[model samples]
Target chain A: MSAVAALSYLVASVLFMSGLKMLSSPKTARKGNISASLGMLIAIVVTLTDEKILDYTFILAGLLTGSAVGVWFALRVQMTAMPQLVGVLNGFGGGASALVAFAEYIRISGDASLSVWTGDAPLDVLITLVLSILIGTVTIVGSMIASAKLHGVMRSAPILYPFQKQTNAAILVAAIVLGVLFVFDPSRWYLLVIIAGLAAILGVTSVIPIGGADMPVVISLMNSYSGLAGAMTGFVLSNNVLIISGTLVGTSGIILTNIMCKAMNRSLANVLFAGVGAEYDPSVQAVEQRTVIRYTPEDAATILESAQSVIIVPGYGLAVAQAQHALQELVNILTAKGMLVRYAIHPVAGRMPGHMNVLLAEANAPYDILMEMDQINDDFQNTDVALVIGANDVVNPAARYKKDSPLYGMPILNVDHARTVMVCKRSLNPGFAGEDNELFYNEKTMMVFGDAKETVTKLVQLMKS
Target chain B: MTEGLMISIYIFVLAAFVGVEVISKVPPLLHTPLMSGSNAISGITLVGSLIAAGEGHGGLSVILGFIAVVLATVNVVGGFLVTDRMLKMFKKEPQKKDQRA
Candidate 1:
């Protein structure tokens, strides 16, 4: 309400804009974050100073406790668990917003003077409150399920039952019906509570049916919903900063979701409604195999030493095997030999977007040599060897030809185009797509069965000799 | 619609546009940190939480308000700290970990 408060919010919005712009570039991202964080601190301080407080006890308690726990999670969580951590944080944001909106509703309804529906207190508040509670509660439970799946607390695969889609639709309808009842009689607080309960349950059911391959999209979509929930809370509180920042996050999430979907050449509807890669029929025969030539680390080293250029294709296997450091050392040794080595990264190479880039960066791999799917796809033709490390579906040749394959039409790294391809995998098990990789049977491809880290380590040792 | 409602709508529309513009330029590689960063921003519920906590309503409102405050604060702090951790790994210079040097 004060001019200074408004001015600070304006400054905060500007800071948020600049911060997001800086995030687009790697070099200025840290400064961008610090600037945004400073803005947040200013916004919070300004709100506290303006709002009449009976006591700062609860505020201070929340701050200290939350910050301590937050610092612990941030510092203690492994890089491999980043997706799950992000998922959990998104859930926390939604739950917080939902609670805040409902609390505001309770406070207003208790105030006899301000609870009027005609003049000062209108239907708008009711609508916003219903929306905030609905979206926020759903996002919270949905994100929790997502995080659980990612953490292996539950199966990463989509857990399906009879008429799962129909059940989800029914829950959504019930929540909406309850929301309608609350909009008319805002004082009927129990109706709102029932709606929140239904929305929360809806969240769990909706996300539970989405398979692992689609997790990145589902998580990002939930992030968008949390943003929308925050926006609804901003409306209820009539806070400009909350509204602007919430909108920013919500829009950003939608854009991210779209990008992830586009990268996989899948539609958002297809991703949400039809869970791909979740149901793998083991009954399908993988009998197209001709010959799988086996090789040892010594042979791998010899091939690498003879090659003029090599492309390293990494995947979830690298993360599971913790082979990033060993692979980096191998790249280092290969670099020393005057051999050209570049990394060809798939869009969905790891568990999520940017996963491969950050994981490899943690291993101190030079970022310049790491190329995106489109950036280095063409060069695979001229490369002497493609070292497929703990990778499968991304480099699977079946995507190009087999119409009946689950991976059909999905763009993949053309590792088979290279003169020779060496695959390091544990067994002949299928990938997330639940289809056998024909590239594993390619004449130019050699199956090097072992843990990626140990195999890469052995290759490093052999290179030394 | 009421004048107050109209103002809220106007603010909401303008903010949504601003948000889209701000987020449009972020690159693909930074998507993870970007998601984390925006998640922190959405924790803007902290403002509402502060108000709810100070309102000193009935027992339920106060309790709910306190829980909300804690959760929002967790979101704000956890989201930013984790994002910062991730971004720190993406430095121009790599760390030296000489295992078998």
Candidate 2:
């Protein structure tokens, strides 16, 4: 039975790896998902077949309940709310691992007199169980808070109060002390409850001070926490397969998180210890802004026709308007007119990392045409025109020069450096962080105010004419 | 087989089945977030590894467990930090408004 289980796990792991690899590219991602799901199905069937359980009722009930809820969430949750839902699911995974460890510990404790059980139950098992519970509880609560913030049920800005940091420190100390006590007295079940409560509080407090803008990172962090808990539980059970899979997930998540952090030009310590994304008024004076160039669709088309090089920068507005395909069409037309067409993708342009890339890839935009911020920012200066569709903070020059701006020191698309710039947006409202964008009023920039898709569509038509 | 082993197998089966179904419905837009978020959940594996290390009475298991715990911790902490950093970019208002005019 163990042999069969091992084989099944091996197959599942292979499928998981392949699925993850396929996920890197959009074209094959769906097929990759299906393949992975099939592998999981096999794993499930094989594991169930090897089980000696006769009481299927409770197991079936659990399966049904979980599936029902999972299906409902998968279907009903909006794409915007998916991050929070993912957080909730991550918490559940941690909680489940913790519960499994607890149950195993309880069983071992119940049969202490049995030498066979005593032989199998090592001190390592007890340690793993406790650690899994503690970390699992923390992941659950922390992830829940992250979900709430993403869903807009809680504040997006860092929820900092006077002495909030001090209180968090105190809670950490208390939880650590409690964890030590639990390790010493495994028989005292109440210690487990206490540790769990303290850990949950720790998780919540850790994430509470993190601002909404930092949610993706927080969510990633929580994901790493849950993965570690799973691996620890696997260690307790001596489950090699679980350890391998858990480690893979844990490492990959960390790497991806690091990539994201680099894109934002922030240190990990600053993100974790400092109250990042806290709302503060900018000290920079609002320049008496003047639009030097306001172009109708026809005028923008005329400029595009004469341009030698054009760089298109996309933002969340593109996603909201579902304008990737339309933008792709526009890109094609410009390319045919002997203009050099490329996309300038800021690392943090949309709601998450690679957001603009994903949107563009979905539209079958050539990968070669999509340029990173660093790669294309310098070219913007030499380019004839920089066209921004629904992007804001990423194009703002304030990040480079204005220390008082909320986006100070952050990397931007350098669209302002272009010879000519065209911006398409619906309104003058501030972005997610509520900081004013300075690029909209630049001398070389042209404001083409409308819905991104509609405006791009009109521009495409004018260009065709 | 022992009832515990049987139950464990059953749990694994159920979890796998459910996990596949849930992941299938996830849209492309939510993929990165879900992946990052789920990675955090998976970091719970570290807690188990940490416990294993503390409980190990002798040399080999303890050493292995400790290494696993450290790696897992790195994964968790680094991953979260990176993720939060990435999210900071989205928090800023597009400064393009000034350039537009």
Candidate 3:
């Protein structure tokens, strides 16, 4: 039975690898998902029916109830809320890992005659058990907070209070002490509760102060922690497949986090730069404020008609107003008119990483036309019109020069450099960074203030006529 | 270390290397799905949850086990469903293969 289990696991792991590999490209992505799901199904069936099972009722009941909820969430959620959904679901994964590890230890403790139960846990089991509980609890708490922020239930800004840093420090010290105690005396079952409580609190407090602008990194980092938790749980269970797949996810998630951080040009030493924007710099005032120029959609159509090329810079507003279809239609009209149209996508463009791609793809926009920030940044200068759609901070020139601004030193698309800039936004409000964008005041930039979908729909109609 | 621990460690190191290598070139366009899909992979604890739920060692263990099972199932089922939904959203550029859900 063990040998068969190992074989089944090996087959599932291979499928998992291939499924993930296929996801790297858009064309094979759907098939990739099907492959991975099949792998999971096989693993579930094999494991549940194995000789270890004493009762099937709990597994089936849990499976039915959980699937009903999962399927409902998957089908009903708006694409704009995908990040929030992912955040909460990842929390569930972590919670499961922690609970399983805790329960396994409890079961072992129930019997004192067994050597493994009577004596201290071997070093490997002890370390992995602690790690699983700590990281898993953190993932659950941190992700719930993150989901709230993304869901707009909580303010997206960092929820900082006085003495936040010091209190967080105290919690860490307490949790670590409890962990050490658990290591020495395995039967102090109550200690698990205290340690878990501290760790969960640590997760919440740690993520609360990370501003909304940092959510992409936070989400990826949290994803990595969940994976790490799973890996640790694997050690507790001696399950090879869990170890393999969990490590894969853990490593990939961290790499994704690094990619996002680099895109924002952030480092571990970002605190030093936090004060860089505290003092109002003279350069911020240097921009000569011009009376805002608001253009009608008809006027935007006229400008776009004469342009040889156009680049659409999408932001969170695009998702908020569900404007991807209208934007795509406008693009089609321009494309038919022999104007070159491409989507200039920032890595962190929407609420989550790769948000714009999913939005545009849902609109049936061709995948080849969507260009990454690095790929399309240089082309903005040569483009006839850089159409800004509801994006604010990412296109702000302040990132390049206003060293004291929160958005300072971040990489932005050079949309301001384009020959003609058309900004389709709802208002003159500052973006996620909550600072005025100097780009709006530029001579070449014109604000067409309205709902993004409404404005884009108007543009599509005007251009078609 | 015992041979059991040694084998596990060996598997851990090699799998980490392979995992790193496997995810090397994921395009930026797939980051959301990548996050979602990895969340599902971490749901491998569903097996552990099953054992705990069936072990029925005590009342407290049974309750915790049931919840763990549900959570793991959600991670597995929900993650894949959402990921597939997102992946299916992409309208391919004149693909030779039929691209229907």
Candidate 4:
């Protein structure tokens, strides 16, 4: 490699690493992203300039088009869809890497001189070719499945057969046997096709057994799979840049997948094979003796006006209403009155981690005031009022005690612990996990029936008046 | 083919457009969970990097492969850690039946 090319790669790598590191914290994630992209740009430019390939025009055109689309997506994609977009982009990356590997294999295989120099004219070339093809093909299929699941095209509930475990095992055995055969005799091109088919089936089956609630974790796991596939293909081609980049992606994906599994308090094996949280028990006896207290916007305003301390607990409802900005306005109003105001954010409040924080931050809510469940749950005792906006499962009391409930053992924000719990919701419907919320019937709880944005806006008006 | 490249670009652009449309429609209450869930997708980069590394040949390739492995590892580890920490906050215990007022 030329010294200049090496220097450029080094710089790009450093940029990528630093950008990834900064991405861990939400505050600096945007900057981290920019830095990483810049590194990638440098790498691409340097690679193109240093290579002897005569097709500069196509390369430049591709770069321009890709960048334009990337920029537009970056500018336009909503924060909520960011995950799906990320998934698709990841799939693209895998697809791109796989294509490069295939191209390399094809180039080498067709050239007699290159094949002779590399080794056994057909065998060595074929081995590399098959490995690249397998890995790249798998990455493409697996990522697509993951993206689909995330986007909700497929049912989020686990699809289980009577002998789910045995079926998965059988598929695995077949794929392994085929892989082994291909390794021994590289000429059997059909073996590679079989392996790809099996891998694709594995991807689908692996994700099929996971529930919607566990999608974030599943997506993370598939992401790791895609990366590993990429790195393996890089090895097949003996490309230093591809190998390094692919390995970085694979390891990070696995670690993230593990983190997601742990977030759901599940093991990787359980996530893959246990089919937990998939069956929604509709027969669980909900306590019907308890009475629900209803409050109009004006009534809610009165409660807020008298409260010495108020905490706003946000959930998926708040996100649905896009009320972060209005909610921030309410917080400002309450805080100005010397009321202790804070946001109680559950870990899995929306559909993913830190979903509330991101939305609130977009509305310019002070990061300091956005409290995690552990940080603010205890404070609910001293809190005169807890305003729940569009939250259900996270605040549902059943998650704590109802053993049959899908969310049983799942930690919840203690909004129910507050002296006066006011929930702003459109209806008494259960949450995504499809379980009724007992917190609604608490004596201290009052339902402020309306859209979260409208309710908050009305409450603000009432407070001002 | 260059056509594939063009198609990929179009897909992303469409994806972004769809993303904005959906976010606008989602209730504020769902924001937290949605964001957390979506962030999980970022983990895909780790997978890509790892596969790329495994294809490397000798010397600098090996070193680069190792680096990719480490970076991907960190991303996966840190991401799950944060996610788990978040999920723990939602598991609530049942209150005593007799304590109900």
A62 Cα displacement, candidate 2 (Å): 2.3
User: Candidate 1, overall lDDT?
Assistant: 0.83
- TM-score against truth, every candidate: 0.95, 0.74, 0.93, 0.73
Off by over 4 Å in 3: A112-120, A268-289, B94-101
Report residue B34 deviation for candidate 4 (angstroms): 15
Q: After best superposition, candidate 3 residue A129: deviation in angstroms?
A: 0.8
- The list of candidate 1 runs beyond 4 A from truth reads A111-120, A286-289, B98-101
The models' CA-based lDDT, in order, is: 0.83, 0.64, 0.83, 0.58
Candidate 2 lDDT, B1-101, residue by residue in tens: 45654554554454444444444443433346337434533543443444434442434434434444443343333333333322222211212222332
lDDT of 4 at A394: 75
Question: Residue-wise lDDT of candidate 2 within A204-314, one digit each (tens)?
Answer: 888888876667677667666676677667766766545555555555445546656776667766677678657565442244354445668777888888999999999
- Candidate 4's docking class is incorrect
True contacts kept of each: 0.73, 0.07, 0.74, 0.03
Candidate 4 lDDT, tens digit per residue, A262-334? 5455577877788865666655435444567787888888888899999888886787788877888888889
Off by over 4 Å in 2: A22-32, A50-54, A75-78, A111-121, A282-298, A320-329, A332-340, A361-368, A378-382, A401-409, A426-438, A450-454, A457-461, B1-101
Which parts of model 4 have CA positions greater than 4 angstroms off?
A24-27, A108-139, A149-161, A239-245, A273-289, A401-405, B1-101
Candidate with the greatest TM-score versus the true structure: 1
Between candidates 2 and 3, the one scoring higher on DockQ is 3
Candidate 3 lDDT by residue in tens digits, A53-134: 7877887899999999889988998888888998998899999999988887777675622234464468688778888998
